[model samples]
Target: MDGERLFCDIALAARIERAEARLIAESSGAARARRGDSVGFARPFAGGVASFAEADSPFDKVAGLGFAGVPDAAELDEIERAFAELGAPVQIELCQLADAAVGAFLTGRGYRLESYENVLGRRVGDATFPDGVRYCRDDELETWLAEVADAFAVADTEGLPSHEEFPRGTVIDAMRDMAGVLRFVAERDGDFAGGASFRVTDGIAQFTGAATVPVHRRRGVQTALLRARLAVAAEAGCDIAVVTTQPGSKSQQNVQRQGFDLLYARAILVKGTSAISSSGADSRQAS
Candidate 1:
């Protein structure tokens, strides 16, 4: 409210969650086209999107829920049926600001709380891309993907550890095919040291993910990447920038240092565990 700072309200949650739903849906559509199959599906349910990128890929979950109120019995049934058909779990990232009825319905149907991810935001203002950070060229896409995937594979011991894991190649493909994504790269001594990305929607700059390679850790690579994306987002006229991060993790700490405040947190709930916990339910794949 004051100074144009964002408030953690239903309106803000709806905007961020809906934008994320559309982005994931588009990314899944792109993945399906690439593989020429029905592996990726985005189903609209409860005013949100229930998407499946693959059995184990991270883009598989229901997002943007509760914005339109709690789902009815039939709507819930449809969502369950859709994921069941794909032999995947019904994973939902329920915003804490969502209607209490929504969480009641989910847990009543056997959805267990698996994890939580904090959503941080900041009003867009002045930002400058630090030296050695720039947009990733088309020719350097593969290298950027490799670095990001590798960084994710090396699990950080702090915060909550991911409940699921995917092959490195799967991670790469997910990042590569994410629709409307803008990629950025950070360098150290003229070598690729880290990468980051963002997507703008309705004046909200969504910082999707960022990571530094193992060899370049603690060298301010992620900080540079974050600044570069913020500058780019401001140039694009975004009013706000947001990122999701594992609670208490280094990523969360890093963004906080950059002036991002905790806008809200998403309670990750799941209904099935027959397969690996639907990967990427956290939204922040690397960061």
Candidate 2:
């Protein structure tokens, strides 16, 4: 397939995964809204009108204010108004397929291209992982969550929700409700060390929430988890596997080391004068 078409497919699949996460959040009684490709969710739930734990996984965000083929300046104005209504400075991530008109409208209204992420993709193949990686059992979710929370805290301690959210009051409770998504964790000396999540839809699988505790960094914990998830995706008949990471990040290096190719760089655009104001409080990259 062509580059633009492939990127769109990846984007759509990512959005579908995101929408599913939001729907699950709403089903779990969290407040959220969906409009085409755009979804708005409430705070502390992981998926909401105000996202607290932003990741590279497609569904890791809370809302999309402008990247819905919405080339109309008038509608763009309405979107800004909606952002104001929500009372959170939501970001809109878009690929190269986005029309110049959309970019122009967002820019004219004070939107800034603050950062970009690389969306990498590759066809399914053999799934080989290092020893010690294993799937998370239903009964072991709490342990897994705690370990992940610890790992994430090490990555960005301030961005995570208080221990009172869900699945110990973190949004992971809603994630556990998602279909076709599986969790894998690594163990060292029989203690949870690192882990990752896989979300499969329309023959595409995405690796998400990969984390390794501070004590486990650079010790092949994530590499093993990644291969395990890819193998699972391939065994399930997936045609493509995708992962997103910040440009020049160590996580990006990990995926590339696993043979994932550079698909496209998705731009994370922020609107309003408060653009990036939430970075210190909400910015945390995925593994």
Candidate 3:
């Protein structure tokens, strides 16, 4: 990989991650705001509240002390406050694009590494729409969401629902009601077979929630849905298309076949709600 392009892609991907987190936060009725170099978000859901990427300082500021150019130690101190304010645990996702110092800082402050994921990206290219692929219409949102939910209901790696059942609604309704999210469904010989959803911003787009039923696998359904989304993104004036996947998963293999490259690996670091015991922040009710 060209070194410059690798860094640029990593940085651009950090921006996309921030946008995605912000969208999820706002949709869940979480409070979100950019404070200095980082964006903080809190939600009422099971997920934790946290921050991503410090803004614009490569150690030139703060006498070389703050991690990722954050103005001071207050960045994380306030993040802790934000999580409590949301009645959630604190979980910060640090992109590889951030300064190495931040990781060390987080570890020193008691955040434990939770998981790793790859942020992949590629320039959108035109592809002829495969047979049975089409942009999902708004009225068909529930159908599209159902197909996607079924695709992901897997109890195993192959995505087969562990309980011999696929969901029909609920989560689909939530996603459909979210702002700025779009879905695309694929048909196989006239039956709804697979689907994916995406959001675009700042000339970039993230293809998310992609899935295909077990019976529909290996039919090129996913690739078709992918290329279709790329075409739509390009026409919408987006240049970069991005996706996040487990580092060594099947989905990574599929997208890599289409020219996508690993931009960076992000670590999900989490701190427990009980960890705040010493900080005396528990009794305070979330605002």
Candidate 4:
């Protein structure tokens, strides 16, 4: 593999490890809440790790799964069958380093791919922010959402998904659910200019939804938002702040200018399924 591809592979492995750790933590919490014993990571003989958290019933909830070291077709088949039996839509993340046949296998099984993003990161350092910007926590969800919606209007273009269509509410809820969230916004002249949301985990703060208003573009709004978020992450003992963007997009250039390096690119595939029936009690809480 070339240097870039090698870098992507390394980054993918690290990301998978980080996600698995988070999954374990979440599963343990869920199990404890129900007063049930937690399940351990199950290593398939073929090569991959799978963990399931019981949801107060026999119905299995796939907490996390990842394949590495060139998994065989049988391994993929086993994974699909296991997840299908759970009666819930399973979420699987396949990095670019994954074997080409993996995508074909998933497609053959009616798994439609959706969404893509590039993971970016930078070490914490001194960053100058535009004057008058302020940082806030989850309390400012509505204000942050509004600024995000406006920024989306400016960032999106023809042939792309509109802000109305994207689930901004769901994103906000997810960020709130995750601990260590640091949300910030830049306001100038009593008007919102830019905003960003991030969560620190395992000493790495992942930055998401950083955007600037249309009229505020090129006015250092985004830069200020990023700088403020990074400072917050650093104060919280995070070693680095990571972000993702579309390849070759203006956002990518902006992040690069802010000293973030392109660690890797991964396609986010999302398949919509019909509503699932559940025998287990609805223990999952709404975000």
- Compose the digit string of candidate 1's lDDT tens values, residues 1-287: 21465677789889989898988888888889888887657888889998888767678888998878889889789878888888888889999898999999889889998888889999888777789988889997888888788887765566766666777788888888788989988889988788888999888999988877778877888788888988998899998899988888888888888888899988989888734443443336344
- Greater TM-score among 1 and 4 belongs to 1
All candidates' lDDT scores? 0.82, 0.56, 0.55, 0.52
lDDT-based ranking: 1, 2, 3, 4
- Prediction 1 global C-alpha lDDT: 0.82
On residues 1-287, what C-alpha lDDT tens digit does candidate 3 reach at each position? Answer: 21123334445655665565655454433212222323433332212223322211110001111223532466557756765554555555567776777678768888776555667888765545566787789787656666666556541252111111212343444445344767777888888777777778667777765777668777787788778877788778777788866556667777777667788776766676423111111100000
lDDT of 2 by residue, 171-283 (tens): 44434433456888888888777877787756777665577877877777777887887789878888777776656766767877877777766566776533232221111
Clashing pairs in 2: 18-59, 41-48, 41-49, 42-48, 42-49, 164-169, 165-169, 165-170, 166-169, 166-170
Task: Name every residue pair that clashes in candidate 1.
Answer: 58-279, 58-280
TM-scores, all candidates, are: 0.93, 0.70, 0.71, 0.63
Task: Return model 1's CA RMSD, one decimal.
Answer: 2.4
CA RMSD of each candidate after superposition:
2.4, 7.3, 10.5, 8.3
Q: What is the lDDT of residue 162 in candidate 2?
A: 18
lDDT of 3: 0.55
Best by TM-score: 1
| Candidate 1 worst ten-residue window by lDDT | 274-283
